[model samples]
Target chain A: MTNRSFEQVSALLDDAIADTREQAQQLDTLLSDNEAQQVWARYALYGRVLKGEAAAQAPADISAMVAARIRQEAPPSQVVQGRFGKHRMARWLRPAGSVAIAASVALVAVLTVQQSQPVAPEQSVEPAFATNPLGGRSPVSYNTVLQQNAPSEAERAQQLRLLQSYMLDHSQQLQLSLQAQQLNEQSEAAAPQKDDN
Target chain B: MNNLKQQHHKKMITNAWRSSITGLLLLCGFLSSSAISQPFQVTDSNQNQAVALYDEMARALRELNFEATLVRSSGTRLEPMTWLHGVYPDGTEVELIVMLNGPDMRILRIGDDTSYYEPHDEAYTIHSDVTFGLLPAAFYKNFSELQPHYQVVGGRGVRVSGRNTHFLRILSRDNDRYHYGLWIDVESKMLLKMQMMTPQGDILEQLQVTTFVERENVPIGMSDVRGIPRPPRLYEVRNLRPPQFNLQPQWLPAGFELLRAGHRRVADSGLPVDYYLFSDGLTEVSIYVGSQQQQGLPSLAMQGRESIVNSTQQNLAVTAVGKVPVTTLQRMVDSMRAVEPNATQP
Candidate 1:
């Protein structure tokens, strides 16, 4: 029989062709032929799988050696999605990460350069009070009184440092004397207790 | 087996330490409560009332074991802090000032050394009786010393901190300096509020006590801070010759006497500065003289209650700093003159 006859037989078995006397005769003929019966059995198995009626069994007809070899290799189904997705993402991020790091480094370089520039007199003297115990009240410089918004001469900065140091020393001295007085009183108070003992 | 034995020993030691700390805290709490139950005497006398009030307040500050939450305002900035003062059984004075907002700025005074602890700075110690940064130094001094510089007059009685208070106006003897107004608790003679004002009545700075708690036992932080080592001394006046200034002040305000006259190395710089310290008992003014060509002092600066006036005479640069009006400091500058080669200057 021609392959066209086999195709008619397959369609009749699936109930896709019109049921008639002619299709019934074709189905009977295909059932008698062993080769056509094998083809019909294969189509029935594929249909069972599509309907999810059976477990997805490996081809038992294949040799054991061939099945084992296939299992040893990477699974073909997941290889493309898993490996290639991560690879593509990493390729895109490389240049972006480099740019971010470079931008931060450039920002730090700019800040360092700005610090070396001469500061305005007000900006320089006013901020020193933040860290000073006297806060913003302490005097700066010994000769030239710096007015608001005036330009600070580089040499005057040294004089300011000296004046601040002097003020700190003076406060320290006051604290020391106070401490000494307290200590003396403490010893004096202890003297009577010692005598009683 | 040896390791297991060592672990058990460590656990026992830890348990003992915990129990001891708990016992100490309970004892302190009990003692403090008992002390607070005692009635504090407050004198409201008609004879020498202002002088007696001042004396009583000074004594309360030095002798009382108390804690106060105060608001200290300078210009537009206001700082809220808790001040604790206690006397140990051994007679050592312990005080703590804890800032309530922002960074933890703490100053702990145990006997002689006052140590400052701040978040950004290294903890350092200063030798002081009372922490200078919290209250005016003059408040701790004897009332007799303050008489010449200030006129302590009694003002109308008012209520402060929920207590009946008497106002003591510490008016400057001269018009050139700032004045202070104090509200003393009538019952305890404890200072409830103090304001430093300009000659024109502009408030420069103020300290108001919101809560005053008197406890008999030492405060909590005071006992804990006793173990912390004091920082090294920052200033040492070694064997160095005193400086001779070419210019000297010709006049000083009434009753203000020269305390000391000497020269010290201007800060860390090797440059010499002539320093003259003058006081009228309560108020102190420091005059620093540096070479005009070497150092540049600001012409005039005023922050809160303190004013600094700077002037140049001949080759000398003179700067005066105190809680005084600009005119008073300016008068000091105007009074400077060059001394003769053979003549001694005071």
Candidate 2:
């Protein structure tokens, strides 16, 4: 019925058919188009040959391969508009119901996988050493470390200063542990070897 | 028929004897176990009494409007603080602790939001019930909650801070951690003096809270805090960063868990450091990890039980400061494992 049927069937084989409407509008043409039918049959035979069902040689024509490559190289499609497009689409819509079925199957697969995705637990920062972290009710002063003697008064001053700030931060920033989660996500997204280099 | 009857009677007598022997064995086992546990029960009762006093002190600390002056004694150094706690007519609790000897260091708590104003550092707030440093949370904490790892024993009554007080010796059940001896006021159930002691009964540090007043209503000192609106809830805190744990100390003494971790810089010297605070319910230690800029650091600085230990691991200078033993700190530093990150910034 139309010369473009061969190309449409080839696009369908490549899973690159853009419009369900266009394919349905040309279904009779594709069935009647001898060259398109021959390509389809050859593809089926070639698949059987792969499965060792038929002792056959390789396909003689590379037209289907060329068609798939052409489809890949083609510019992406835009929405079809205008009165004529609507007129054709209305007629093709009934047959194109099969496309919706295929889409529903794909959606089910995606949704099933989404349902299995586990959710990460929530974490909140609590007072340090005051009690059990898993929520035992206690406020016992938490005990931490020990250091050797500072070499000199100045060194001791520096150590003392560091210790003061460190302890201050230690005591003050109990909620900082919440940042660990963001740190984990950032680590995965960021490029490796960026820490020291 | 008579022989059969006699045999049946003999079997019943044997069965009864066996059953009686089994019952006797079971009774003996139970008695022995109970006898062995009788001393444990006595200790438990004594511990319970001490813990009851501790709980009373904890409740008093929370519910009472009190103004207390505290002095921290560790070796020759002495630091003082003014601790105030009160509740509003609306049931909003306010607690404030201003370090008297420090450079404008203080901590304020309004309900669950706690704020810290360190001497030269940007004052920041956290959502927590307990404040760190100065007078620790342990003083007002229920001692029974530290059980399984810690135990409390009743000690002889003694006068402390001009009040008749009873001593409640609270220590680790396994003797692997620091111990505390609290002198609680008998009448008021307030803690007057707390001694951080070692397993050897040596005092590591002592905090003496001289009770000035425990008012029935809100303390007058809290007038400054009343109507003081809570600080604006922090922005979605992405920009306000905390110290991150890039290097984690994998080993800790038993019962110690990471309480908090953050990144900060020393005000005296611009030294960026990563630190982790670990606690064992009673005592806490801070482990600081920073890049080794120059050579190694001072291996240690120990004054009494308080110690600051430094070591270099994987080009990162690690320091641990706490009131625990230096060896434990060193072991913790040695256990530093650099977290494998996809991206790292030194």
What digit string (tens of lDDT, one per residue) describes model 1 on residues B275-322?
776767566677877777666554543323555556776657787766
Which candidate gets the maximum lDDT versus the true structure? Answer: 1
Judging by DockQ against the true structure, name the best candidate: 1
Model 2 regions more than 4 Å off: A1-165, A174-197, B1-42, B98-107, B115-124, B138-141, B229-248, B260-274, B301-306, B337-346
**Real contacts recovered, all predictions:** 0.16, 0.04
lDDT digits (tens) for residues A1-197 of candidate 2: 25465566667665676787876755665577787777777666766766779631221122233223323421211211222242342221111102122223332332233234322210111221223232342211111111222145465445445544444343333333323323444568785846331
What lDDT tens digits, residue by residue, belong to model 2 across residues B1-346? Answer: 9999999999999999999999998787666545532332335456667778888988877788877777877645576766777888888788877666636455677876665544322344445555545545566567655766777777666787667888777767644466788888888887788888655566767889754466687655555553443322222235544655478877787888876555765323446777577877667788777777742354433323444556777777887776675445656776788676742546
Provide per-model DockQ scores: 0.06, 0.02
Worst 10 residues of 1 chain B by lDDT: B38-47
Model 2 DockQ reads 0.02
